[model samples]
Target chain A: MKQLRHFFDLVARTLFVLSSTPFRMKEFSRQLYFVANGSLPIVLFCVGFAAIVTILEASFHMKLVIQNDSMVPGFAALLILRELGPVVTALLLTSRVGAGFTAEVGLMKTTEQIDALRMLGIDPVQYLVVPRLIATIVGTFLLALLASMTCLLGAMFVTDIHLGYSPAMFLSSMRVFVDFQDLLLAGLKGAVFGAVIPLVSCHFGFLCEEGAEGVGKATTQSVVVSSVSIIVLDFILSYVFSYV
Target chain B: MIEYRGLVKRFGAKTILNGLNLRIEEGEIVFVLGTSGTGKSVLLKNTVGLFRPDAGEIWIQGREVSKLSEHDYLEVRKVCGMVFQHPALFDSMTVYENVAFGLRRFEELSESEIADRVKESLARVHLKGIEDKKPPQISYGMQKRVSLARTVALNPRILLFDEPTTGLDPVTTRAVNHLIFELSRKMKTTSIVVSHDMECALEIADRIVLLDKGSIVTQGTPSEIKKSEIPLVRGFLEEVLA
Candidate 1:
């Protein structure tokens, strides 16, 4: 309980420090660009290709085994919207933005900058971690939305060409099964994933020791921990959402 | 004023400060001189409640400080500003922000008031300009002065310096010594400086305390300490002043 109280104090201090400083829009925008904008191409590519592959396999299996193609569009959309979209986006971000945060903070720790903040009466968590957390949630929210839309469109294209289904028919079928709740679930999951990655990455950074070797160890630990945690969280959240 | 009575600090089996007793008056610039690993830094940290003694009492300005809660410790810390061995400036912040960090946090000053205090503190350390520069962009001596500026910005009643001139060249060391003397007098702040350099200690101390093996071997005016006949004191004086 004493440890929990200290953690709460640290979180409160972080919030206060961020509020005291004027928001640096330029810096935040640059980070947002890296976290959201720069990852767009990779997110689109992975999500789009997943759609194509899922449609092809589902159509083939249904025709051969069950003699039905009625649920192909709904199945693909549900899988993409609820599972693949959120998980893939989070995995890419965990590797890219999460690793960068850990490295930057780890270097600062090695240089005694965090100690400097403490001596100067500034809580390091407040000055460094809180702003990054806010930016992470915001960036991840937008990226998940974009990835979901692009995946659905790509699946529609695949159905039109391969299945001889008209674009109008594919669109109408998607509209029938896709609800706003699935999109909300994916965005919420992305935001949660974004929040967790940095928290774990920074925990590693804060525990960093001295010298270059320590930084290498910390960076490696951050990547492994963040990636595994994301996968596990996605599974749990997906299970809960499916049951509900 | 500060007093430590029968202070005992031990790290497992290692004794750092053993049965130490000392007192400081207001506006006195006392130099604590000792060899390396003699617990000078630990002693200084104990004054601000950073390190609690194993069995002792620390009284600062008529208040028992070692047992204060965190909130009260914050208040006690505000009454003292510390200049670490190295200038511990915030790397991401400019010089002005570094100096203004404490003032903004501990006081309810407006932006302009905080700005004025920063300028005044910088001027006190002869760092009038260069507020826009980062700490690393400055010379080692200037970095020390910026640390002083940051320390003095709070206008604390006590200023604790932990090995203020350990790694500087002779010229920079001399400059820092002069600043220490001048600022303590001008601000009338009780300054507790820890150093292994006997020359620096002799140059600025109103009273000199020598510690050996976690206890005060002897203490006197600089002249008195210099003339002491105790073998340990004489040996240390010989080696450090050599």
Candidate 2:
């Protein structure tokens, strides 16, 4: 019951902060840089490899069942857009950006910087959580799009070299199989994962106990909780969005 | 003005403050002196609504602060500032930005005016210049001074100092004490300083309230506290002054 109450409280606060615009644009921009730009290389690398592995595995099975590789692009498109793109990106961000937010906020709490902000008549939520939340939501959405594109490119490369399918054939197959709804669902999932990462991270960070050990624990919990939340949310969202 | 009536605070099975009552008049400097873990810092935090009492009433400026909501408490907090023991300045920001933080948040001033106020506050703490340096780049004493400047920049009606001179050398401790004295006298702001430093309490406090095991052992003028008959107060003063 207490956890449910806290979850709802965090949701309400996040909405309130999102609507109240123009409070701290500078901080928001800085956080965007940290979240999006700082994680670009890793996102690129991970999505590329995930795309290669998925295509290779799918083609291997297709050869056994149908003795053809023409269906590989469609299969890859379905997996990447609906599942791998957003979930993989979210997991990466949960480890990188989410852990960073938790550790930073935990340090500030231990050092009494958050208390100092309250003493100065500044709302710590407005000054700290809002910017980070906004950045995570927007950054994760964009990174998911980037990941999807990178995966397609990687799948094209793999099919061209190993499966005797040209890059044009792969592109044509993806265009035929992947629709606007798939892309929309992927984007929506990205935004949900984005919101969950910061919410879980900041919640643990704010509730962190004192001392260095507390910070370490909070960081670990943030990553673990965020990853689990992303996976669980992915399942739920996929189930719900499937009907549409 | 501040008033605490029958305040009670506990952590788990251990009580930190018990039925503590005290009154601080406006423009007066009161020092809370006690050994470590006697709830000296806890008492100061309670006054600012940082730590709410389990059962009690705290009145500040004729308002029942304990009943104020989070939003309402922010209004009350604006009239008060707290200088922490370790100088909790934002590590990422420069000295000027730290002092200007409160002013920028609460007040609408031109850039030049903000700069002037930041400069003035720093000067009041004898920290003129070095505004571009970050907190980590400065010495510990200077960091504390920057923290003081940050709080004073808001021009709060009441100031709370929590063990402000705890971990400083004698020279820096004396400087911090002197700065507190000058700020209280010059600004006519009601000040409550929590510390275990006898010399600091004796030097700047108009009245000293000594705490022993979650209760006030004695409360009197500095001269009267010097002549206190309580064994805890006497022993603490002897140990600190010795």
Candidate 3:
């Protein structure tokens, strides 16, 4: 019951911060730079590998069932757009950006900086949480799009070399099966995961105990909780988006 | 002016401030002296509405602080500033940005004007020409001074200090204490410093209020407190002054 109350409180506060505009625009841009720009290499690398693995597995299964490689692109596209792209990107970000947020805010809490903000008549929620939340939401959405594209390119490269299909053939096959709804589901998953990552990370960070050990603990907990949350939320979102 | 009437605060099962009552007059420097865990810091935090009291009334400058909403508390907080023990300068920002933080958030000033104010506040704390330096790059003493500059730039009516001189060498401690004295005298801001440093209390405080176990053990001018015969007060004074 207490956990539920805190969760509701966080949701309410997040909604309030989202509705209020013109809030710390400079901080928002800085966070966007950190979250989106800083995580690009890792996001690309992770999604690319994930795509290769998915394509290998799907192509092997398709060869056994239909005795051909034609279904590789369609199967790979469906997997990437509906599951691998958004989930992998969010999990990577959960480790990178989400843990970073926890450490930063947790350190601030330990060092009395949060109290300093309040003493300066600045609401810490408005100053700290809002910008990060907005940045994560927007950054993760774009990164998910990037992830989908990278995965497709990776699959195409693998199939062109190994499966005896040209890049154009792979592209056309994917385009035939991968519709706008798949892209929308991926984008929606990214948005929800983005929101969940920061909310959990910041909550743990704000509730961090004192000292260096406390910060370490909060950072670890943030990554673990956010990763678990992303996986669970992915399941629920995929179920919900199945009807669409 | 500030007044705490029967302020009560607790952390979990531990009671920190137990119906503590105290009053601080405007433009006067008051030092709250207490050993560790005696709630001196908690008392200062309560005045700034950082920690709300369980059952009490906190009035600052004729306004009741306990009843104020978060928005209303910000209005009250604008008239007050706190320098924490560890300086608490924003780690990501340079000294100039740290000092300018409050001014940017609370005041409407041109960029040049904000720069001027930041420079002037740093100069007031004798920290001129180090605006580009981050908190970790500076000495601990300079960080504390920067913290002071950051708070003083707001031109608050009341200033609160929590263990302001802790962890400093004797020289830096004296310098910080003297800075507190000078700033209070020059700005005529109501200052409440919580410290275990009896020498600092004697040097800078117009009045000393000593707390022991969540209650005021004694409250008087330095000389009066010096003459107090209460065993706990005398023993504490001896231990701190020795």
Candidate 4:
């Protein structure tokens, strides 16, 4: 519970600094490049496989239960846009980007660079967290949009070959189950999940103890907490999106 | 001038700083000498509002600063610059960029003016022609000097050093100690150094303060501290005496 309060405090402080401080475009661009471009191929490759799995599994289950795989495309598209694209991408990011943020910031703290920053009259929140926060939010949103497109295409391709459905047939059926709004909601989920990553990462970082073991523990805790936060936040967002 | 009045800092049940009180005059170099975990660094941090005291007040230039907001603390930090135990140079930036970071933030200097000041600051620390080198690319001693250069660029009224010579070799240690003395004496800044090196403390400090178990054990000029009979003081002095 104390940890939760500390997390919220970090969020509050980061937001306050974000609003009041001038934006650092150079650092923001650097972080965005790392978040989006650096992780792009891995995110796309993994999500593509997830899409194939979703298509195949949905076909098999529907055929056994209902004796027809006719709705597989629509169901697969619905699942991809609403959850798989954003959540899978985010969990991947939580491991890749979130862990990186934790280790980087944790090292800074252990090395006293954070104190050095404060001594220079530059707030660490303003110098480190703010740029990464902005970059991650923007990058994750874009990645979600791209991941959704890639997953839908992969699912379509799988339905045409494995499920014995044509591409046109898959698209026609998918239109009935999901729409553009699902994609936007998925992007929103990505943005929120992105915001959680740096906050959790940097919070553990600022509170990091000394030594390699301390940094190792902080990194593990940061990853665990961020991944869990993304899942919990996903459920909340999904529940809210259900109405929309 | 800076003063700490009955300062207390606790982490959970462990009190790191207990009723610690000290006064530092303007344009004086004070060495806070203590063993590990003795709250020497904590006192320095609390002075700048990096760590707030659980009880008591900190006054900088007659302004009560322990309660200042982080934004308000910038004014205090502008007057008090700290060099950490580590080099603490930003890994992502070159030495030139690191030194100019503070100038770009607090001063409205043009790019050329900032570059000139950065060069001058680095030169003050006896570093020249390493401007484009990143922290990792340079030697550790050089990195430490660059960190000092970064802090010195701001021309702060008070300078704080946290074990500035901990990991260096004897030659580099003497060089850094001399650099600290030179910077303080030449700049005429009030300097507080947290260190465990009694030998260096005696050489550079105008006043040496010995701390044990989070409180002052003895504080005096070099001759007075050298004459003290306290066991802890004797223990610290054994190496210097040898």
Error of 4 at B78 (Å): 1.4
B1-242, model 3: which lDDT tens digit per residue?
A: 79999999999889999999998988999998877999998888888788888889999988888977777888888888899988999998999999999999899999999999999999999887799999999999999999999999999889899998888999999989999999988998999998888877876689999898999989999888889998867876798667
**C-alpha positional error of residue B185 in candidate 3 after TM-score superposition, expressed in Å:** 1.7
The number of the candidate with the highest DockQ is 4
Superior candidate under TM-score, 1 versus 2: 2
The true-versus-predicted C-alpha distance at residue B18 of model 2, in Å, is 2.0
Candidates sorted on lDDT, descending:
4, 2, 3, 1
The CA lDDT at A205 in model 1 is 79
* lDDT tens digits by residue: candidate 2, B1-242: 89999899898899999989999999999999888899998898888888889988999999889877777888888899899977999999999999998898889999999999999999999988689999999999999999999999989999999999878999999999999999989999999999888877887799999887788989999889888888988887788677
Each model's DockQ score: 0.28, 0.68, 0.74, 0.80
RMSD of each: 4.7, 2.2, 2.1, 1.6
Best by TM-score: 4
Q: In model 3, how large is the Cα lDDT of residue A140?
A: 93
Candidate 1: tens digits of C-alpha lDDT, residues A157-222: 988888877778877777788888888898998898878777767777776777788988888888
Span of ten consecutive residues with least summed lDDT in model 3 chain B: B232-241
DockQ of 3: 0.74
Q: After superposition, how far is residue A43 of candidate 4 from its true place, in Å?
A: 0.6
Report the CA-based lDDT of candidate 4 relative to the real structure: 0.91
Q: Which of 1 and 3 is ahead in DockQ?
A: 3
Candidate 2 vs candidate 3: the lDDT winner is 2
Q: Write the per-residue lDDT of candidate 3 for residues A1-244, one digit (tens) a residue.
A: 6655776687788788678756778888999999999999999999999999988888898789888878878878888998988999999999999989999899999889999988877677777888898899999999998999999999899999888789999878988888899999999998889888888888888888898899999899889989988898888888887764
Could you tell me how far off, in angstroms, the CA of residue A83 lies in candidate 4 after the best superposition? 1.4
Report residue A46 deviation for candidate 2 (angstroms).
1.2
